[model samples]
Target: MRTLNNHKLKLGILDQSALMPGDTPTDAFRRTIELAKLGERWGYSRFWVSEHHDTPRLAGSSPEVLLGALGAHTSRIRIGSAGVLLPHYSPFKIAENFRVLEALYPGRIDLGIGRAPGGMPIASQALRYGRTKPSDEQLPDVLRDLGGFLADSLEPGHRFEGVRAAPFVETKPDIWLLGSSSFSAERASELGAAFSFAHFINGDGGHEAVKGYFDSYRPGPLGSEPRANVCVIAICADTDEEAERLALPVELALLLLEQGQFQRPFPTYEEALAYPYTEWDRMRIQVNRSRMLVGGPVSIREQMLNFAGDYGVEELIVVTFGADPAARLRSYELLAQTFELA
Candidate 1:
């Protein structure tokens, strides 16, 4: 991997608002707030919540709503959606929601939008509420409207010429396009928006995707220079063995999820350990492990720094998964110290 001696790497967090078995959604919300506060104190650059629907394991179905509470609880760290599922909602409404957040916490909100459905068809249909499913071809138009609304720059002859995402704050939330492939990278570049690659979801082809974004990038509202970040699953501990132990739950969760077993509140480590596994299951775990960064602090730091350098990105957004909330927090704490984030 390439090395950048002068680059100052940045660290951010992506919370899924994971629900432990027997934990209520209310408890999950409180935990997210607590984690945000702790992350701020620990020197994380940003605290982002993800959107998921019809999944009991993830309580953060409405990242915009959670972002409001996170902004209220944390004084400094930037708060945002890991992303909002753009296809299900109106671009106008999405702009207004983040605009309200920016109005409340100017210069500290990020609006990360994605084209994914974020859930099963049933839940997705409910979100659309009888509306037609948005096609991939519509993303460019959706992004155009979203940007226009945020910047108050809708061109003449546009359908919503007079419409505005009101409360028109001077500082709009920073906008980012989130995706697991080059499609979003190209779109973000075309729109001149910041791009975040979801490496945790799809680790393959990331190099080409990042390169595409950088090559096609143009100056826009966020800044004159190109900006991008890689989001990945990272779990760190004092020792490699312990870190691996802590990561078992998520590994098993992903494996089962791939097998079409959507168990909510994720299985505990003991449960995962107790379950019988065949050779194929073990192989599948190894395959899924390719997308994660798991190890002790020193190892994780070295790997993540190399990952950032290789991708030519200075920022890394980490998502930690485990049944124990304390273990999750500890993982971030270790990473914060390892990266010397502030």
Candidate 2:
């Protein structure tokens, strides 16, 4: 395993918004390209696209497709899914597609796997389409199968022995297991894969989950000690006031999600501030704010440095999707500046 030497903080971006309201897939693709370019220019080490289906606010439904598009545009920044819901796809197909991506991009591809359904129950059903009786256990099985496929093992002389992924690609992509819960920590540790905790979704101070991963870690082909990454929700602007205003969309989006408003694209920060919401909604937003950091570069930098120091994270990935594309890009730029890249 690589030793941690208090190296400079690593940065990455998570692009969740595809289009605001009326933007088509083409527009979203272009925006993705622009975001990737900005990420590379701003010193972001990687740019990960999330897998979301049937969500009007989210543009990345197929990470494999989006990754290909991103692969063509960016130069240095690595690209991959923040994760692909493994239970929804065949492990073989995933290995094949990502192998092709790895071959194309060489050293600049990441494979982050998540066990969640990645969509509403109805949408998930539609995605599976013909599959019946899909079990949660399928995720673990797929992860294991993927590891085998990537390791290029087929057992001795078995049928389909040493069958390489299509495109005849030969490269082992960096893999990470992503989750918002402890269930994933132990699983990733057991498999010796890098672990990424989604602090945005799972409340805060995931100390127990991180400890569980480290304590349970057993050296495997992929790693020796646990390689853990922390994912946080961050938004930075020139002023604290502007940052707070920009954060309104995220707060509203969370509130709406908690209240069963999934597919609706949230209003802008100014718009959200003007609209009327219930007291409960306001309270929920406040509670959610505790789990995120929203402010100017100085404040964001201080918070992130403190967070990284306290958590001992090897990598820090930020998910900064806003109601507007400009705000989203601005957030990335501000993060880069905070990291002294500007």
In order of listing, the candidates' clash counts read: 0, 0
Model 1 TM = 0.96
What lDDT tens digits, residue by residue, belong to model 2 across residues 21-110? 788777887888888888888888788888988777667888988898888888778898889887777777988888889888988988
Task: Extract clashing residue pairs from model 1.
Answer: none
Q: Relative to the unseen true structure, what is the C-alpha lDDT of residue 173 in candidate 2, on a scale of 0 to 100?
A: 80
- Report the C-alpha lDDT of model 1 over 272-326, residue by residue, as the tens digit: 8997989999998898897899999888888888888889988899999888888
TM-score for each predicted model, relative to the true structure:
0.96, 0.91
Error of 2 at 280 (Å): 1.9
The C-alpha local distance difference test score for the whole of candidate 1 amounts to 0.88
Q: Which residue pairs clash in candidate 2?
A: none
lDDT of 2 at 188: 88
